[model samples]
Target chain A: LAKTTQPISMDSYEGQEVNITCSHNNIATNDYITWYQQFPSQGPRFIIQGYKTKVTNEVASLFIPADRKSSTLSLPRVSLSDTAVYYCLVGDPYNNNDMRFGAGTRLTVKP
Target chain B: SAVISQKPSRDICQRGTSLTIQCQVDSQVTMMFWYRQQPGQSLTLIATANQGSEATYESGFVIDKFPISRPNLTFSTLTVSNMSPEDSSIYLCSVEGTDYGYTFGSGTRLTVV
Candidate 1:
């Protein structure tokens, strides 16, 4: 199982672009980086996933470099409601069943 | 994409009692995962429920304490047996989505007093 490490918490103001990075030193060849957003008292929602390069959805964008040892999740013009815990998971969900979650970063967007 | 409906959204149970949480998926999935989240902490994987087979538990988790049942592909149940105050946490169920990510249920907030 591949383990991920990210910051415990982050502070950002409204309308600012926030970037949260996760480092997976032992990432596998078939592992894909996936990011999930979780609100209080609710389940996690899938934000974006990428195997390599960059992947952008309406909600967020995932950037992965050539080394694939780390990935970043970028939130553009974050709002107060966007404040939540963001989890970075590294695994091959297509072929593996051991999908584990890291400590995650708690992003607090202030006014 | 799949939708999961988990029942008994929040419950307060007495100690030494068992609570069975049910999860029903809108579509069939190969595996259903169960997770636990303590207060102010991250999520922890409990076990993987596979249909017609024994559930695979992670380290520090045992089947005797958390018995899982997967009678079919669309539904599964997890019973937290002989609950204690330490077992009070948010229990969630998840399934791998057709997309690259996984879909999780809203979770069951269990409080054992």
Candidate 2:
């Protein structure tokens, strides 16, 4: 399992783009970068995932560098409802049993 | 995608008592997982529920304290034995999808007083 480091908290205004970066210096070649969003009292929701370069979804986008050491989750036009904890995980998809989540970065979308 | 549901969305139990949280998925899944989230803290993986076999627990968690049962692929239960104030937390059940993403239940909030 690879350990990830991210900011404890971040604040952004509504309608602005928010980017949360995660550092996983020990990421493995077989590992893929995934991001999850968790709201209060709800389970973590899958936002976006990518192995390398950029992957975009309706909800968010994931950008992974060639080195695979770090990835960034970009949420465009944030809203108050987007305020939640964001977790970045790196692991092999085949071995789902060992996936783990870190402390996560709490993003507060201010009005 | 799988739809997961948990019973007893919230419960208040006295110390030394036990509460069983149930998880049911709409479709059969290969792996089911249990997790705990303490207040103001991140999620912690408790164990992996295996069908027709014993569950694999994580470090700091024991089968005696958090017993998990998986009779089939779509259903599982986690029992918190002899609860204490320290046992108060949100217990969530999850299953990994074919896409390698996790789908989780709403979570059962247990309050031990």
Candidate 3:
């Protein structure tokens, strides 16, 4: 399992874009970068996932560099409802059932 | 996406007593995982529940203290034995599918007093 590091908290205004970066220096070649959003008292929701380059979805986008040591999750036009704790995980989703979660980045979208 | 329904969404248990949390998935899954999350902290994997077999627990967790059972592919249970105030946390069950990323139950909030 690869350990990830992310900001403890971030503040963003509504309608602005927010980017949370995660560092996984020990990421493996077979590992995939996944981001999950967790609201208060709810399970974490899958936001986006990518192996490399950029992958965009209806909710967010994931950008991974060639080195695979780090990845960034970009949320466009944020709103108050989007405020939540975002986790970045890097691992082989198939083989590694033991997923380790970091402290996560708490994004606060304000008005 | 798979829907996981966990029982006893929230419970207040007395110290030294035990509580069993149940997780039922809508579809069959190869693996089911139990996790514990302390308030304002990250998730900690408790064990992996395998169908018709014993569960593999993590380093800090043990079967005697946190027993697990997976009678079938779609159902599992985790029992917190000898509960204490330190055991107060949100217990979550999760499953992964080929198409779906990962689905987690709403979680069981246990408070020991």
Best-fitting candidate, scored by DockQ: 1
Report the poorest 10 consecutive residues by lDDT, candidate 3 chain A.
Answer: A91-100
Count of residue pairs whose backbone atoms collide, per candidate: 0, 0, 0
lDDT ranking, high to low: 1, 3, 2
Q: List candidate 1 segments past 4 Å from native.
A: none
For candidate 1, write residues B1-113 as lDDT tens digits. 89999988999999999999999999999999999999888899999998999999999999999999999999999999999999999999999898778999999999999
Cα lDDT tens digits, model 2, A1-111, are 549999999999999999999999998878888888999999898888889999998998889988989999999999999999999988887765356789999999999
- Where is model 1 chain A poorest over a 10-residue stretch in terms of lDDT? A90-99
Specify the CAPRI tier of model 1: high
Could you tell me the lDDT of residue A36 within candidate 3? 90
RMSD in Å for all candidates: 1.1, 1.3, 1.2
- For model 3, how does the per-residue alpha-carbon lDDT over B14-110 read when each residue is reduced to its tens digit? 9999999999999999889999999999889999888987898889999999999899889999999999999999999999955646888999999
Q: Candidate 1 vs candidate 2: which has greater lDDT? A: 1
Candidates 1 and 2 compared: the better one by TM-score is: 1
True contacts kept of 1: 0.84
lDDT per residue for candidate 2 within B1-113, as digits (tens), equals: 89998998999999999999999999998789999999878899999887989999999999999999899989999999999999999999989865747888899999999
Question: Which structure is stronger by DockQ: 1 or 3?
Answer: 1
The models' CA-based lDDT, in order, is 0.94, 0.90, 0.91
